[model samples]
Target: MESEIDRFPVKSLMERYSITRSVLYKRLKGLGIVPTKFGRQSYVTGKELTLLDQLHDPNCNPRDVNRWRVD
Candidate 1:
């Protein structure tokens, strides 16, 4: 299968999520998704972004979040 995702760089993620770098890292850590490193920049997959959305959405149940978590 193709591995690449519609990834976003750290700067764009920060702007899109309105989160600081520290918070972004923490959230990524919580989701168990590793960011792809390119030189000094870090990028996250669209799948990861969806997980973050579920995590932050008040309408989403906590159990639903766990279903998508990476090993």
Candidate 2:
């Protein structure tokens, strides 16, 4: 199980992936990954980030990510 410390803010994700906010959000939508939002901040876990990384990979088909589970 992942601890709370492993969670990251959406802004950090944007920077780590070197993607624009719009692009990241759009991909998140397409991937069906809804981040936990608290006020102005959005949180994503390391597991979720791994999935997102796969989704961001140019060679990985988005459709192939259906096998990924949050757990």
Candidate 3:
């Protein structure tokens, strides 16, 4: 099981990425990233967060899924 420290809530992710909830979910869906559910809340793993950061990085190529190390 993943520890709490390794998980980030959806709301926090929105703030961290400076995006709205709709945009965040849309990006995640486009990236094929499904957030884990904890009761009524949703979260993304630390690894996913790293990928998200890269996805939003101006210097990175969003189309390069193989380089993301998502698996």
lDDT on C-alpha atoms for all candidate structures? 0.76, 0.78, 0.79
Off by over 4 Å in 3: 1-5, 61-71
Question: Candidate 1 lDDT, tens digit per residue, 12-67?
Answer: 87777787989877777767889899999888788887788777677877555456
C-alpha lDDT (0 to 100) for residue 13 of candidate 2 = 81
Cα deviation of 18, candidate 1, in Å? 1.3
User: What is candidate 1's CA lDDT for residue 27?
Assistant: 72
Candidate 2 displacement at residue 41 in angstroms: 1.6
Give the lDDT of residue 51 in candidate 3.
79
Worst 10-residue stretch by lDDT in candidate 1? 60-69
Stretches of candidate 2 off by over 4 Å are: 1-5, 62-71
Q: Pick the candidate with the highest lDDT.
A: 3
Ranking by lDDT: 3, 2, 1
Selected candidate, larger TM-score, 1 vs 3: 3
TM-score of 2: 0.67
TM-score of each model, paired residue for residue:
0.68, 0.67, 0.73
Locate the minimum summed-lDDT window of 10 residues in model 2: 62-71
Determine the backbone clash count of candidate 1: 0
> Looking at model 3, which ten-residue stretch has the lowest summed lDDT?
62-71
Q: Give the TM-score of candidate 1.
A: 0.68
